[model samples]
Target chain A: MRRPDHQTTTLTAEAVLAPYLREQAASFLRGLRLQREHSAPADAGTQRADEAARALRHAARRISGTLHTFRGALEPVWADQLRAELAWLSGTLAREHAYATRLGRLLDALHQLSGASLPAARPPSGEGASETDKERAALGVGAARAGALLERRLTLARTRAHSAALQALGSSRFHAVADAVALLASEVPLSPSAAEPAGLVLHAPAELAEQRMLDAVAALPPDEAVEPYNEAHDALWHQARQLLRLHRYAHELLRGAPDPALVGPGHALDLHRDAAEAAAAASAAARTPRIAPATAYALGVLHADQRHEVEAARGVFRETWPHAAAVTAS
Target chain B: MRRPDHQTTTLTAEAVLAPYLREQAASFLRGLRLQREHSAPADAGTQRADEAARALRHAARRISGTLHTFRGALEPVWADQLRAELAWLSGTLAREHAYATRLGRLLDALHQLSGASLPAARPPSGEGASETDKERAALGVGAARAGALLERRLTLARTRAHSAALQALGSSRFHAVADAVALLASEVPLSPSAAEPAGLVLHAPAELAEQRMLDAVAALPPDEAVEPYNEAHDALWHQARQLLRLHRYAHELLRGAPDPALVGPGHALDLHRDAAEAAAAASAAARTPRIAPATAYALGVLHADQRHEVEAARGVFRETWPHAAAVTAS
Candidate 1:
């Protein structure tokens, strides 16, 4: 009787699968980035260039954050690869020689290119120049020679920085990050629509019926706990009878010449024997413990009152009352 | 000079440790639930008893969902445990006998004690009997029976539904749906006053001053292609300069008692030597086959405007141009 449609089933399957797919896509993209070249310099000026590198580093950090957050959404198989790529990038940035060079070169260039020229002579008398001027002049000449020596060093540092940045761009990390962004962009729009299928399948009329029963029970006075319990108990009994009837109906429908595989080995035969035994047991149990009206009311009160002994009351109902009813009816 | 504070380090360590700890806690809680008596039903009237059982099952389902979402945010390690618990619950619910008997017994007891008796026999047609009376009698018995059966079946069905819900609560899936929520719940928040010792050490002005010479040359724009070969050449040269400066600074700081072990052995020493060589080579390269300033400017323009042959321009800059003015000054 509870026939779920294929669409509902498929939707459930998709819901289960979506996370895996997303993770896979993200990892693949990260790997692709690591294998490619895509570093963007911040600016042309030395100060700005350093700023640019800093900005790029900041960007890398942001990407790592995004990857971390998105890691869960990705498929399990893909998550490992993505995590590896992200970890590499983060580690590289933390201690990369090239990054150090780039930052250093930018700072050095800014210092050199942003000031007025000084003559290689005695300290000139200027408003800002004094005893420190003589000291600074000597330092400047020494610094100039040192700067010349450092020129070769600066060139190397710039080269290394550029190389590292390029290497990072070319790595798989880039592609994975890109892919994740794309997936997020595409899939987000479809979420509202995609939710409909699962909603439809899980929508059962039984929920409304159960709700009504609960509301009726809840409306009873707090002191009249037994009444609520009785109502709830009767409601549940009614539900059991309905299930039994439905099970019987299903059994009847499938009884004749059922496929051996469908029923399993001797399962059908066992079921018939079990049914008879259950009926007899029910009749026998019904004979010994007849539930008086007062006891039922008391049980209901205990249940409604949320008594600690509610479980004991339920046990009495389950073990005693069903058998009594069957014996009395027979 | 680069002294990182203990508190910052500790916080960073805590950030890394939080997820693992939370995952362990969730796993332990779930294990507690799986233990026999913790989640078992209490005895009571069949109907009220069924309600209690249903309530317990619902509670378990809620707990499972919480654990699952927690696993996604805090730790992937517990994913297996969460999955296993859900699978077990699902398999149990799929079987009819598991929940049906317990529900049925509870319901039967309620009916016997409620004093809501059914008619024993059909009466002959009488003056009081109308079409509605016959309809009520026919429907009443059937309705009561259906209600009893439904009570038991609904609990099982709902449990199954809950299992399905749990299966669908994948980490990636939930994150994709609500990333901010996941981060807030899972990510360890850094205090506003948390010390950034690493940042302080790296950005120290004194450290920047010591490396000013190398920094200047690095600011030079590349004149050749930005391909890996050229980039690597530039990067190697840049790294050489940075290494040289760092070595010199370290030597100055350590004085004569510099630790050879700190300098590293074999390949690391060779790398330091090679970096020096590379820096020298980049400087030598900068002196020859220099691109005309106009050409260098044109390349810069192309990179900024057309974004074409940017790599080639970078290559030219690396090959020509004695370290840029910025490197010497900054």
Candidate 2:
């Protein structure tokens, strides 16, 4: 890795991205340290770890996304390898969180059906006591058992994800990635193209990101987004969410911050992703062999709840996109 | 209060209804005794009380609905007064349960948005640690506070309802109602028409109940039931739910049990009622003055979730209604 002349750097791609990369690298390292220090059994410590995880995940996404978007300005081989490693790291960290989220969603939905708001409160009434008898009388007999089944499955999945994430964090490969990031904080491996003017280097990709997102948004069938929500459309909407995210990240790279026009739609997309994934988890849980009809019925209801969430998110996106598009165009 | 001669009793409306009234009165008394004996501080005792409440409520609904349905065969003044007292008793008992149910629903929805499935688990993390940092990072800043605020308001409401229910149970009016029920167990106050044949007295009213329910079901706009769930339709669906319940009760009186054909649609209506009510609670919570934007956002998501639930329930009802109607017609 050779450095461009200090005077030349002021006008080159290296000048703009070197600082951004360095900041993300530092945040990643700092998150690793904080996560280790805050790994206590208390709720506070777990929260700190989760926060550290978020910081780490955020930095990883920005670095990986930037590397891809700016590959022309960087050493191609090194950028590809680093991007792959960041992807691996992000995936590992996110797995347990995904399971936890899905479990929380399913259990909350079950509680909704059972009319048992406080499952922790062991009602003195025996059998079917989690809810008021009125609720139980209406909700039928499968809620408690359904909840227990979902809990058992999801808890196991989360625990396994936790173990896998821990294993990855401790692996030699993770350490290698960490070492590479540390070195990059001080010296980025740049290509001959890195000497190009910053705007000339970044503008094409930024525009492409925006165009791709707009195309996806335009492709969504406005007609199907409402009544009789089709699951098939969920994939298309999820792609739009991904594209919007890429566009936001590209804006951050080119403009030093995400586009203000993108924020509202970004939030709606995040909701769409969470809800769609939650609905899938509920559907999976509903398929447990030999489960009680009541349990199946409750899971069906839960699945429907998430699907509605998916539609609701889509509704928000539809409402927000026109305004966002106008703002962006202007 | 009078009994017809033994030979004529077999053919009279009183012959058919007296046994039903006696059985309900006995169950109500039994429920009262169980509730008093089991009113301990433990979860089990609370559950016992809840069950007793259910039994009492069930008996009251049955007796009250029966009186209304069979008013032609019963003494009007006595029937109306007793029905009014039963309504009072049922309302008092149901109020606490309703609040508890609504609170549970809101709390669960909050938990769903927060991504905190196990709120009881005081994780090592502090502050926003109720959810995975990933969830908090995505859900925005208002979730914990929103949850706290909703919990406070709903908890207070539930407590007040509990107090009112307790006060009602201890009132002299409750004792008077109980005395009337006990007397009815042995002797029903009958109009001269009570001597009419059982089929002549009960069949027309039972048929009327079924007709009303059918008409309401027919009035529902199938087009609005899917995406873009309109809240205005919720009240109409709720009315349908009530009518269905009345129809089921009428069937029980004529057929010795609820019409088997009605069971599937009945469950769907129950779901519709629950989801519609939950959506309203979520909307109300969202309107709390001076709440943070994040809190409001979360509530908006929750309200949407419940609305989806309402639609889901409607979907169920729609799917089941045709089959139920076919079976009932057969």
Candidate 3:
């Protein structure tokens, strides 16, 4: 929603938040319409469907984040129920993309290392071309099988996710959520605090969100102390990513736009989360029962690469923390 | 370009490629119109502008790629000149996005690690919350200034790129290329070789492209031997990516779509290129004269993060090469 030209200090919480809630709810309905009209329910899916899903997710996230961050200014019971429903919808929709991205990343890795374009094995020579040919031949072994294995496993997972998502969208639970959001578009369930000036009422809650995010980031083990590809640290960073997002949403509530200070870090944390999840996917694929040793080896390498990405993101966070701290101080 | 269902064997080279080239050229013109009409040249860009830029880039790339891959099937002089012009336009337009992405990545890294949301400082303690607060304060020092430095540098670069893109779009060179492409849509510049059946003449060239890609891959030193984050190796991988793209375009010319075999590797190579370039950007940022030590430290970490991403992508490509080889052999 566009920000009011007048100062936020003069506005009521209802004035600031009601329009946003209504807009997101309306957006959700529009997304649903676009998705249904553009694609067959039983079909594999299309770019239009994907775009609709993204719109739905974006609206759902903003709504969910708003409810969570601004809970103190809303009717508690209603807010909690709606927040839970939004989370359910968001989680269901996210699964397919997660599986798809992981599969793409793994398959791409396999394709890059494979020599499907190269000739069959040639005699090794001292020159550059020969060395490449030898390496290509060595690495090409069992690559097709590996690709097939990953494709089969991940595709199944993605198809399942898609079905689950479709089912969820059509279910009574989703309809109820939609009904509630539709009602929200007409009337937000505000508490006594909503009567206060928007700026004054919202400041503490936003601050709390920031404090939580900071606490989470600070609690992480120093980069050097953590083992390379440490799962425990990875989990913490994922949690930190969520906290940062909450802080960002809260910041948006306060200022009308997402805090510029947090936007960059929020994006970096997103990359961290994706890398961690992808690494986990590779690890899972590697654990497939009685897979070929070469397939396993390739999966292992894929896993390691993602893990390094995780560490790299963490290093960036470590470097960036000071700027965030300085912003807080100011 | 919707694919024609009939077997490619019956089609002549001109019969197959002329329509595709025409569609891409029209698409390019449409993108240019969308860009010009949607926003004022003097204003900071909008989402519409970005979308237009992407459309333009896509069309330019497809045209250039097709020209290179299908050179033997067309008038060589006409094709080469057009290809060169398309490359120039693509590169010029690419600079703004590149700088923007680099800036976003660096800034996000800084934001994620900063303590902008935390309290200024706290006494150190063994407990989790206390540990977090202490760490947040430590990391926040000079982060704001570092962010400022990077923002200034990258934003300047992006602005310059934007201007260059705009100037290129308006230049006579671009107009000449556009005119040639417009004429091409009606009358394809054909060579005597174009008389051959599409499948007959295209095979060897596509095969040759693949062979060159494979040879490049074959030329690289063994993975273990090439030290991690090796620049020379990164450059080689970049070249391999181009060669792979040429083969992919060649394949698409023969078949109706891109080789499924190469798509996955192509995406991985794209990531490799982006990461390598981002790493270079960070290194350059770190080298800014008279910057604070803390600012330099943050940039160094950012540089390291991107370098690791580069290596990670390389690892994926390594694991993927065999699949490419398998497809090539078959």
Candidate 4:
């Protein structure tokens, strides 16, 4: 599939995707170099290098997958064009591995020179020079030779210009792989919540998110009760919403869309059945509100000092104190 | 000078300074250990170790200078207390260095083991039967050996928790020396615009600091012009202020009060004279408005279409047009 020249186009996805890929690749390569330099020679060094290589490969695969996905979404002609481009990229990667092998040799040579005593022996010069002069001249020659070799290799590859393309492919592949891996690694069994049958239940990996929710609730000031408590409640609601979104996305990807039969024969035909049920439940919950102690204290303060309705405020205080105490103990 | 209590009653200055000195010592020792392990040959390794030692000594001297500065600020009795604590710290550093030499030898032995191929001998009695088990067993042995040696040393120095103190002192010293060396090595001549007119300038070696500033600026939104420009202006103001503070502090230490003669006449009474001048300049620059095409277009869109203030919006557009054109041309 190839995109028609006349098709409405903003920024080409490749234009955005290319630089992003290249940056990720460059960062990964730099990290690899640093690890190679700093890590002590041990089984750990080998293990670390293997892990890094695995990560790089995973990243490359992700980029390839993303390109494929984008191609699938494009018009038939454009899809074919993108697929062809990806095919070319895969071919280039094969050749690039050869270049990497040569680069490895160059690196090894550089490492050797670094380890060698400074003022290395002069390359066979016919001149009868003093030892000091010979040493100084040799040092200059060795440095120049290294620089020239590196420059020639770089020029051969047109590395400065082509690096961007290499980077883009690598990064996209990485992200695709990472996303797939995360999906596969998730262990929680999906289920429907009892309180809200329409809502998908999530078993949190740990109590950390829940603990943060509790702390936020406890930290609310007595004087500014409702707003603070509501903010925390909202935060928890959002966290729950995120879990729902993830569950929906995962379910869609894994098992296609929701089955109409699950909601019952007639219910599936009703377009707003799920929405109406959810809203009704929410409104009922809102009517029978759970008041917390901080809420009570805030109401008390408002009544006593801020000249709010005394009897109404006292009623709210009495209702909320038990929940507030329970929340504080937790 | 000995503190009267001998064990306690030292000033807060001495407490802070003692830890700083100890950290410097510990850092120096760690660097020495790293050098000994990494350096290829005995002679070269010794030279590197000696260099690290020299750096530690230089840091120790700086700590002594700071102590003297503290002494000048405190009462005579407190000054005596600080001096005693400083002397004890300096003595501790010397002793710590001796222990570090022994530690370096052990590290060197471990470094050799990392590079060595395992001997094709029968597995030791404690070695495991399975391949995975053997690996685990070897690791356990290595850990046990290291731990035992460390514990033995700690036990021997149980009199005053001398081993822990020494280790802490060595680590601290190494860090201080490394930091000072980094500062000295990386220092670059500040641009005239960034330089302070008077007072000590604490800089993170110009290249690193400049890179950090540039990174921060680059991370800002391209259209959000206020923050990037303001940050540069603020940093200059901050630098000037710091210099002024240091000058005042130094002057206070040197003399009972700031010297009017050194500062000069009426205008010199203000310690932050340079910083105030820079801040005023920055403030004036910020207030000096620049009209851009985008700004004019945004204003026109907001007032003309949204607010329906055609006449007022036209006036603004006309006023800004020339400056906008000038900006575009540039």
Candidate 5:
């Protein structure tokens, strides 16, 4: 996809920021409402409320991302503090949502794997199904149990997140955010640079994001697979994930109008980040003491599977980055 | 689906049993091969091994089911012993597969829900995507986390399963099973009743299975939803599940030649059994202690959701059975 024109990108940022912030603020509020609804007696079902939680998280993220991308346009202190507050809110909602989603994702991936899996498992026809069909059914039963375990853990996490959200809702900072949102157009102390016409907004953040991604990749040891369990490996992966996240959000600033080439990498990068995160979770689960021996065995399987996926994702990223770089380089 | 003609169904049973047993034994051996392959030096990938594990499970189940479904034809002592060992083998394989599958199913369901879900999470997007699309992306992140948590635990369960499988393959009982499978056709324990024509074969098992299913369902409390928690509820659900399994097997004996009316109810019954099992799992998960408050809350959400599904299944059963009764009665 051709690079979006820089001149238009700058104007796009200026034109969109105020409305964008308002929309984000509105999204946050909307999510907050659903959060409250879930804890209430009404049977709104978790579906809506879950979306709300995600909305609040994404809005907060984009808000922060926008502030960073357009830092020169606003007062430094105000942006910093507001960003902090939004981060808190996002983190709060993310806590439970993250766990719940991860549990869901892993379970799904395992089953999906079951479908095309293990042709040798094909049962002799007089009794049952062919390989994957029968195995898939059996896996379905096990997946239920695994899901149950996750649900228990995720419920507890969500309880804590909701509590945190409630506290934040009532805090002075929350009030300040609300007031700031109400007067967002006038309150953001715009500087002379805010009016710059050359419009480096989209290109600037994208360029910064790519450099950071490259630097993160550079910092990695020659072979992560050698001792991926170590702290350095984990920290480096985390740093790269954050950089990738920044890049994704930077692209989001294109307001869905991003260069077409950017889209695929955005998804690929998310997968890379998630695979790394899942591998880490698998390792941690392995170390959790006093679990049933069977449970321990299962976790080990999950860990190995995830570790393999992590390696695959890294490979994917290595392959994907050059294309993205080439597209944007021109 | 119309109930299958019992005349043809009876013929199907006779044709299927020997081949079924042979196929099951073959499946068992094949699965054993994959299981060993996994623990070997080269990476065979967990997907293949996992399928192997499940194949072992289904093979054992079918062997046991066939022995039960055709009990009169085989030697009483031999059948009992074989059933016992197969049950043990099946249970061993199942302990791990069940956990893995449950994890996958729940995570997948949750993510699917996330996509059409979290309506309030609709971000104000100038991007090309709609509300659900954007919300789904955000939910994807959270789902990834939830999946990670499950992957950890499932890996542990699978590790144990593999170990257990390795042990079983080396056991005296396993050896006996193998011997029995090898000499299955030549075994001298056949009763004169084995030649008693097709009269007693099909309908007897069907009648017996239906009676058992009905008995188990009758044992369920007047209102299952009022209190699905206690030991009795669990035991009854388990019994019903087993009965359903038998019925499904009996139906499979008919293959595509089933009594036309049996087909719909067969599928419905499978769903019924699954929903009930899932609900039980959810309840158990909810009872597990020391989870975070958020996790507990999430468990409750899962518990409630499964409970509703269970009740819905019950309703579906109630609706389906009457139609089946009318059709079969005629």
Candidate 6:
């Protein structure tokens, strides 16, 4: 889904609210487009269908994040009710998004890293060149086999996620979320406090949202305690990652006056989350109750790899952290 | 060591030969410096020593590759024997480089991916900002523990490689190789065929080398036959990768006038080797005799990842191979 279009001449509460609602509606329409081709069943195999599913989830998340940040600006009861419904639609779309994106990402990585040999472009000249070119193309026997395996399993996962998404879309609860979002564009319910002044309503919440993010970061366990070996530390880092995410979404609502601190710093925590997940996967692989020695060794290699990553990330954080930078600059 | 320095006043066989030996000697001296810092035994914990070990291995490989490429330029008996010795030295250093580089690369990825929030720049113009900054820095406790685990394991591997390298240096066999290389600079024994004309010496084998590389590529199984599901297919890809490697070495002997078809197209095969090895590692992990289902699943995932990489490399080869370019340029 697109970011909220805040290029309105007026920056009222309703104006800001309209853009957010429009963003959600745009995503909902995209999801509907995915299922329009078939009468009875939905097919997830189409690349456009997959993109629509991801777009729908992204829209739901942004709507929910905006609600959390600016609940005070809107009518409390209506805002709370729509927030719950948005969360449901988001959950419905999440599984499909996760599986589809993961498969897409892995395939992309393989393409990048497989390391292509010199690409044999067609020569404008003679026929002998084309004959050998064809002969050389015949030698890429291993790639075709590998592609088939990934397509089967990943497609299955994507289809299953899509089927679940289709079922959720047909449900009454989802329709209710759609209706609420549709109403938001024209008949937005703003609180008395927000109705009185345009500047106070938008700017205060933006600043508070940034403040809350900092508070969340402060609550996380200190770096010295988040040692790579400590199991407890990953949980803390995970919490920090979540908080950083919330901060990012909060800033997205105020995209016009962007806050670099609120958005980009969260990216650093993305690595922390990845390292933790990788370590956890390795651990699960290792602790596979009655694990094989070879499996255990492989798990060891993976664990070591991720743990090393955790350290490297921490080193980078220490180097680039704005707090550290501020201290050095001062 | 650096690749051969070909920007020369006179590109004679010995002129080219002298630079290669000097490059290897420079790398050797650097390794010796690492060990000499201590009166006692070598310690792998020193980052400098680890760097030296890797440098030495790189130097050895280039020397060995060059020896293979231009064996005709020197005495047949001397060249073949010294090539073998250089390979032994290279193999010893390879173990350490492989482990160290892998650990380093993985760690770098973690840093890139970890999503950190609030890159705290210069603390706000207040006392409270500094307080929180100090508090936040203390929170990265998990990374330290993980770092320690990787350090201990990687350092041990590095130390073991260094010890092996040191022992080889002291042996009479290595001394013989060193003496042979030293003699190469001054009293070089040249084959009569090579001594005749400098132009003939370089060109004949280069052409032969290119032809051999092409023959090897042609020998590999066609793309349709190589399926990921069949274990037999992986073996064929492995053989192709080896031939590509030999071809790359052959061309390193004539780096002054590079054959793009010769040098780069082999990189496609480099990924093939990596994928094969990764798959082998995963297979070993899977076959851990009485393997647990979880361990087996993890190994399966790892295997699938590498197998996918193999397919990607093949796809790339099919696209980029410069067969048409070679003929068109000619």
Tell me, by DockQ, which candidate is best. 6
**Model 3 over residues B1-330: C-alpha lDDT tens digits?**
435534556887777778778878888888878876764665446888889888988888888888887888889999999999888888988888889987887677667556444333232333434433433343345356667987899899998988888788789998897798788767788788787787677666777888888888887657642234344356577788888887776666666687666766788899988887776665555446565544544453455456666766877877766643635522
Looking at chain B only, the TM-scores across the models are 0.24, 0.86, 0.88, 0.20, 0.71, 0.67
TM-scores, each model vs. reference:
0.19, 0.50, 0.50, 0.18, 0.44, 0.44
Flag regions of model 5 displaced more than 4 Å: A1-6, A9-19, A33-45, A109-150, A185-187, A198-206, A218-234, A251-256, A324-330, B1-330
RMSD of 4: 29.9
True contacts kept of 3: 0.00
CAPRI grade, predicted model 2: incorrect
Candidate 5 per-residue C-alpha lDDT over A57-105 given as tens digits, one digit per residue, 9 for 90 to 100: 7777877877776677667788887888777767765776666656666
DockQ of 3: 0.01
Interface RMSD of predicted model 5: 17.7
TM-score of chain A of each: 0.29, 0.86, 0.90, 0.21, 0.75, 0.68
The residue-level lDDT of candidate 2 at A84 comes to 98
What's model 4's lDDT at A132? 26
Error of 3 at A88 (Å): 1.0
Model 5, docking class: incorrect
> Where's the lowest-lDDT run of ten residues in candidate 3 chain A?
A117-126
Best candidate (score: lDDT): 3
lDDT of 2 by residue, B3-24 (tens): 2224332566777777777888
Give the per-residue lDDT digits (tens) of candidate 5, residues B1-330.
233455443553344455556666777777767776774525423677667767777667767887887777667688888888778877876766666656666565445433434322122233313422432343344335434544555567667776776687788987887777666643334555655544455467666776777676666555544222222233445556577667666565545333455555456555655554454443344334443322322332233344445555555655555434422412
RMSD of each: 42.2, 18.8, 23.2, 29.9, 16.3, 12.7
- Candidate 2 similarity to native, TM-score: 0.50
- Order the numbered candidates by lDDT, best leading: 3, 2, 5, 6, 1, 4
Q: Tens digits of per-residue lDDT for model 6 on A196-297?
A: 444557666666665655565665555642234333344555555655565556555555433454334555566665665454444433443543444343
lDDT of 6 at A234: 49
Task: Please give, for residues B1-330, the per-residue lDDT of candidate 4 as tens digits.
Answer: 222222221233333334344544465445545544533334432666457545655454444443344333224354354345545554554454444443443333333322233322222232222432332233234323432443345334332334443454457654554454344233311223223311122111222323333343333223311111111222332332333333333333222243233233212212222222222221221122342222211111111111111122222323332222112101
The backbone clash count of each candidate, in order, is: 100, 21, 44, 40, 72, 50
Window of ten residues with lowest summed lDDT in model 6 chain A: A134-143
DockQ-wise, the better of 3 and 5 is 5
Provide per-model DockQ scores.
0.01, 0.02, 0.01, 0.02, 0.02, 0.07
* Lowest-sum lDDT 10-residue window in model 5 chain B: B119-128
